[model samples]
Structure formats: C-alpha cells, structure tokens
Target: MSTLSGAPAPPRIPEAVHRRRWAILAVLMFGLLIVVLDNSILNVAVKTIASPEPTGIGATQSELEWAMNSYTLVFAGLLFTAGLFGDRIGRKKVLVFGVAVFGVGSALAAFSGSPGELIAYRAVMGFGGAFVMPATLAVVMDVFERHEQPRAIGIWAGSVGVGMAIGPITGGLLIEHFWWGSIFLINVPVVVVALIAMALLLPDSRDPNPGRMDPLGVMLSIIGLILLVYGIIRGGELANFSAPSVLLPMVGGLVVLVCFVLHEWRTDHPAIDITYFKRPAFAAAVTAIALVFFALTGVTFFSAFYLQSVRGYDALEAGLLILPLAVAQMVVALRARLIVDRFGARSVCTVGMLLVAMVLAAFVMFDVSTPLWVIELVLLMQGVAMALITPPVTVSVMQSLPREKAGSGSAVSNTFRQVGGALGIAVLGSLLSTQYRGAIEGHLSVVPSGARQAAGESIEATLAAAERLGPAGKALIGPANEAFLHAMHLTALVSTGVALIGALVVAVFLPDGDPEPERESAEGAPGRALPVSGR
Candidate 1:
C-alpha cells in the first residue's frame, strides 16, 4: 500500500491491546449498544410519552417526532468533526469523554418534564453519540491488524442490529414495570460500566498528522439539516406545506446547504469531500443507504403505534411481537458479508432492496385486525432485507473511494444514514399525522368543538378525548383505530415506493465485487482510521 507523501508514521499498537482485542471489541460494542439502544427504546416508549400528564409527558405527535429527530440532527451533523477529534486527540480519550457526556445527557433526558425539554436533552445525547460512534470504529482499526479486520468489522456491524432489535423488548420490560423515564435512565449504568472498562481495557491511538479541522463546514451542515428537518416536521403539524413557516425553513435550509456545498468545494479543509460522489459506485451506495433508511425508519416509527394503540397490545406484548425482527437482523447481519463476498454487492443489495420493498408493501394490507403472525412475518423479513443491504452497501462505498479517503467514506456513510432516518421520521410521521387528522376530523364531533382539532391530531389524541367523554367516548374508539390504520397503511405504501426506487438505483449504479486488497482498506486511511465495514 502506498502512503501519502510526507504523511506521519502510523501509531504503534501496544502489546496489551493486541492481547485483549476481543475484550476491547466488547468495550466498543458497549458504547455502540447504548447509542443505538436509546433510539429503539424510545420507539416503544413514545406511546407512553404521548399519554396525558402524570402517567406520561402529554406530548403531541409533532413533539414526539421532534424528540427523536433532535438527536439524529445533532448526531449526523457532528460525526465528521468527532471522527477528526478522535484522530487528533486519541480514540480512548474521545471514547471515554463521549460516554460520560452521553451518560449525563441520558440522565437529564430521563427526568425531562415536557416534550420540549426532552428534545433538548436528546440533542445533548446526540452530541455525545457523534463522538462515541466514530471513535469506536476508529479504535477497532487501531486494535485489529488488517487480516482480522473484516471479521471484527462483521461482528461490530452485527451488534448494531442487536442493539436496535433488543431495545424495544428491553424498553417494554422497563415501561411496563416502571415509569416512562426509566427507559432513558437505564443507559446510565451501562455508560458507567463502559467508562470503567475504557479506563482499563481500551488502548489509545491517534493520527500523528490529523490535518485542518473543519468547524465552518460542520456548523453549516448542522444548521442546514436542522432547518430542513424542522420545515418538514412543521409542514406535517399544520398539514399545510404552503404555509410560510414551512416554506421559509425549507428554502432557507436548501440555501444554507447549497452554501455548505460551495464552501466545501472552495475550502482546502472541507469536512466532507463532495468530489467523492463523482464515483458512481460510491454515489449509488450512499443514496441506497439514505433512501432505505428513509423508508424503513419511517415504517418502524409508525409500527409502534399500530402495535400498541390499534392492536391493543401492552408495551411488553408489543416488544415481544417485534422480537422476530430483532432476531432476524442479529442473525442475518453476521452472515451478510460472506454472502456478499461470494455473490457480490450489486446482486445481493439490489435483490435485498426489492425484498425490502415487497415487505413494506405488505404493510398496505394491515388493518386493526390484521393477524399477529402476519405482522411478525413482515418484520422478520424486513430485518433480513436490511441485513442484506447494510454490509455490502458499506463495503461498496469504501471500495469506490481512494484508500487514503476512507475516513471521509465512513463518516459520510454514517451521516447519510442518520440524515435519511431523520427525514424518514419527519416525512413519514407527518404523512401519518396528515392522513389521520383528515380521517378522524369528522369523528371528532363527538367531543367539544374546542377539543375537536386536538382529538383529530392522532389516534391517541382521539382516544384520550374519548376517555374524557366516558361512555360516549367509546364511540370514538372504533373510529380512531380505523383512522390510524388508514394512516399507517398509506405511510407504509409510500415507504414501499421509496424502497423500490432504492432498488432501481442499486441495480443501475452500484458496483460489483468486494473491496480492494486488505492493505488498501481503511486501516491505512489518513486521519483516524475508518472501520473496514460499518455500523
């Protein structure tokens, strides 16, 4: 492998780090578990949070969406900067600091009194997550030699699925037995354990020459994304995209993002290298990640409500229902790389996208009384589809980039994934709200005129109004369930379309084959080392 001219020598790995690589991997996974787990847990807990005061935060549908998007906005925006910090400061230091900050943020979020406060604290958690996520991958490269990285990366990526799948089940147990806040509170102890292990088992590694940090680019990206997502969420809340509030932010966000692109093109020290998108394979792979996550995360957001509110499952039961999804993702992700290694990314991912689209389309058939097994089967297949897509798409992205630019490749991949997810939740959540509000509006006449608008906001709102109406409110229950089912089906159908588009993109543009020579992988990438695989 060729080293860049005048690049400083790579950091030497300590004997102890090599000796305890697996344990070190455990430490890294612990860090990853809490970051991914927090979001998945909230998916289950969102219902409880939407319940009226005393039992829940009494949040509206838009507030609940903000609570999730806030974290993603901050996390996606700061990821590149955090990865750079890890290379400049030391992965161990950044990992430990990020864990501590995340712990404090989780503790704060657990006690939040309102949706607004929860969104704020969640952003703090995102700040910590940005640092922790990249550092962990960088450390994996530090500890493992090139020969073992592929396997190590495969396991690392698999754990991400495990974290995502297990969270709903874990949150179910907690939300059933304890307060809604306990879900967030649970992260504190895990963060403590991870911190202690890092202090002991984690090794320090840094780039001897981590060039020019890009604060301007990071700031612009963050500002632009937040503005754009805010506009989308606001449009949903009003059910009117033509409104000034929606158009203003959406246009402003677009303008800022354009400025960000221009700056990156002009600056010597850009956070993201836009030129990389010139590579057809890299462009297609990242777009697939963006679109797939956009579609899937949106459906996942609505599934929690469909399970608990429409189907009348308890939190625990809902969690158990999603267990098949978790199991499939965890089981299949571990094997996706080997499948890709033999079959190539283009075939596996394109087929995977089509499979994903088919499963999402199945959701169009769900109603208030859809069979439980059918729902489980859909989720199981959804997990398998995602597992097929993530690993190979990740490898293809890296394979297309110059070996020296792999750090940017990894950061850019994660940024797109997070941004895609945030948009999914915003766009899809808004669609559900708009459809439900329309469907339930006539039914809201059962309540006072003043309460009608509120009740029409969501099925939960309608049910809460019905609960206040006592026996008469019983009339709203059937209608509320029907309306919500209508909204969910429409949203799922839209997601299916998005997934199909991703399949077309992958089939047309993604490259074939595994990454280049082991030596040419992310191990020797400039700045902090990028993972050979992905999250």
Candidate 2:
C-alpha cells in the first residue's frame, strides 16, 4: 500500500472492543473529566487563592497567571509527541499512564505550600493530561465505525461541557466548606476510578506497523512550542512585543518551527504527516478550534474575577452563576450534528462564530448595577454559540484523516486548542492586568506608601491591601471595582473581534457541504472480518 497509494488499509477493531465501545467511551470521558475539571475548578478558586493566608497560599496575580501558563506550556509542548507515542506504543497504556500521573500531580498540587510549588506541580499535571487528552479520542476513532463517529464525537465533546458544569459548582462547594486545596484533592478519587475502569474495559490498540520514530523532529517541536509560548507569555506580561527578550524568543521559535516543518516534509517517516494540513478543510477546522478556544478561555480566566471581586459574589455563588454557560454547552453540543447535517459545516460554524462574537460583545453592557439574570442570559447564549462551533469543527478535523492517522488528527486538534487557550490567558489576562493597573494607580493613595505599587497591580491586590489597613483600607474597594470593570469591558471587546476572525476563517475555507472522508467504505466490506481491513 505504501509503495503504491501510501494510505493504510481500513481499521478493524476486535469485535469485543467494538461491542464494548460505548462503555469504553464512558471510561475515556472519565479520563477527560479530570482534565477538564481541573481547569474549570480553578476558575472559581483563583480568587480564593489570591486571598491572604489561612484560606489560600496568598499567591500574587502574576504568580496565579504563571500557575495557569506553566501547565499550558508543558501540555501544549508534549501533545504531538504524546500522540505519536499513542500511535506507535499503545493508546490504552498511554492513557492509563497519563491518568496515573495526573492523579499523582493532583495530590502534589493539593499539598503545595507556595505559588512556585503549585506552578511546578501543575506542569506535572499537564504532562499527564497531554497524554490522556489525545489517546481518548484516538481510541474513540479506533472502536467506532465511520458513520457513527460523529455521534460518538459529539457526545464526547459534550462531556467537556459536563465537566465544566460539575467542576465550578463542585469547587464552589469545596471551597466554601474546606481548604482551597480540597479542589485539587477531589481529582484524586476521580483519577482512581478512571484508572480502574480503563484497566477493566479499555483495549490496547496501536498502529501494528509504524514507520521509524523521528527523535530530532520530536525535540524540535517541543523546543519550538516552548519558546513560542514563552514569548507570548512574556509579551502579555510586559504588554509590549518590541522588547529584545520577547522578540528574540518569538523570532527564534518561528524559525525553528519553520525548520521542523521543512524537515518533516522532506524526511521519510516524519513525526506528523505535514501534508494533511495542506488540505483546506483540515486547515480551517484546526484554525476555527484554535481561535474559538482563544476567545472563550481568555474570557473564562477573567470572568471569575469580575463575578467575585467586582460583583461581590462568593465562590459558590460565582460557580452557580457559571452554570448556564455549561448547561447550554451540553444541551447544544449534543444536538449540533443534526443542525450541521441540515445546514452544512460551513454555515453552522460561520454562523456560530458570528453568534459567539455577538455574545462576547454583550458582555460589554454588564456593569455594577447589571442584574444577575442579564449575566446568566449572556452566558447561556455564549454556551450555545460555542457548542455549535465545537462539534462540527472537531468532526471535520478527525474525519479528514484516514482512520490510521487518527492519533495525529486528534493531536493536531487538541494541541492548537491548548495553545490558543494559553495565548488567550496570557494576552487577555495581561490586558486586564495592565488596564486595571493604569486605572487604579492614581487612587492607590488610600494604601500605605510602601504597598502602593503592589496594591495597584490587580483588583485582588488592591482589595487585599485595603483589608490590611483595616478601617482605612475599606476606601480602596470602590476604585478597585471600577478599574476591573474598565479592563473587563476592553478584554470582552477584543474577544469579540477574535471570534469574528474565526468566523471569517470558517466561511472562507471550510466546504459548504461536509468534507468527505478518504476511505470509509472499506469498513463494511461485505461479510469480511479481516483484522487488517485496509492496505
């Protein structure tokens, strides 16, 4: 097949695996749950973590930003290589190992006594998560037949919404009644459950024959992503892209990535088949995923602060406020396929991204006096827009590849989504920080002279400083809230613009009809049950 067509034969799962696939999907979702849950839980707990000791580790805003970015940098860096591992070594083994490591990292993160320790531990969690995320989807690709893959993927994508719903509310409850560490600690039991179920139910599957591993290619990819992401984070930190420290790494990273791509294109047995990305639909699907998550995650990172710090909601209350967003995601995601079938991927995605842009702009109207129901309505709308965007685009990306290349497809999908999120947090979060600092600097006179600079860094810092001053400190609250609102408004506007950019990409590139898969007819070859169904 390689000498002639270069495409592999159709995939055939063991009948046992096929029979147990729905159950196996549940186990995979359990694995995905902890990964999604960790981030969503942090959304609500970040405010508490910024609080002074006894309740939290008293992490500064920058440290908190680092905490999130550290996890993302490592996760994005390793994802493609991890996918290659799944394809070559085994999906089930890699999934189990990843879940186990996630559990260990969770426990370590729960025990971290300082911001630095927590950041390090979170990176460890990312290492495990990098493996878990792609393998689960690859396994889904393995067990399900082509026609049924969309439904399976929809439900699978919807599970992320479920995790989003459960995480915030659960974190809210735990934070209200117990230590903040309890949020991370809760992941331990879920991990244990996922591991056991995986052991019992998951089938070990891999490319029975794979080409040579490209170690140099893997190293180059890791280095390139880390450098690029580091540059993005630094730019956001300083809010300036011209600084030598920022420009150097960013330029170096781009050159390295270009080299890596050229090498893979020329080399036999390249780490990822770079040619697949040359397909328009495949490229658009990846772009849409990356851009949407970029808009969504950046907003998500700051909304917690806006809800709690600016609007005076407690952790539990803020979590509850976010429920509508997740609920809409779950409901709409499950039904997105039917809509796409009628309207086609291009129409649905373009329209969805436009709706997302509108929803983000809707956030601009919210202020101190805005009613809670107004916020909830906008959140619900946001969820529906995202749901419409996620499933079709995901299906497009996965369906483009031959079944044998599912691991790489899944890797391409998740890797960009994570990188988008990483950039979103760094870029948008930095915008919020910078805007708040400028807005509040003149008013920091309410704080002691020594603490004025720190107090103006963020709304949380300003509030914390005010509290330290006792009665005199109470004066800082008004200005802090006002400053954050200004920043939040600007960030939301920018996110709306990003969503529009995504919409434009989808409209210009994705096919008006569903993109046909390359070779799915072989899946049902008369009565043939050949294990090697393809080339």
Q: Estimate each model's TM-score.
A: 0.91, 0.95
Instruction: Residues 1-535, candidate 1: write the lDDT tens digits.
Output: 3356656644444555677899989889989999989988998898899998888999988788889878877787777667767766777787888899999999999999989999999999999998888787767766776556656666777787788778988999999899999999999999999898888778776655547888888788878877876786677556677899999988998899999999999999777778778777789989999999999998998898989888888887888888888778778878887887788889999999999999999998998778888989999998899889987777666555543344455667787888788778878888888888888888777799988988888888888899999999999999898888888889989998999999999999887755443223344643344322111
Clashes of each: 0, 3
Candidate 2 clashing pairs?
9-534, 9-535, 10-534
Name the TM-score of candidate 2.
0.95
Residue runs of model 2 more than 4 Å from their true location after superposition = 1-11, 519-535
Please provide the root mean square deviation of candidate 2 (C-alpha atoms, Å): 3.4
Error of model 1, residue 366, in angstroms = 1.0
Candidate 1, number of clashes: 0
**Error at 450, model 1, angstroms:** 1.0
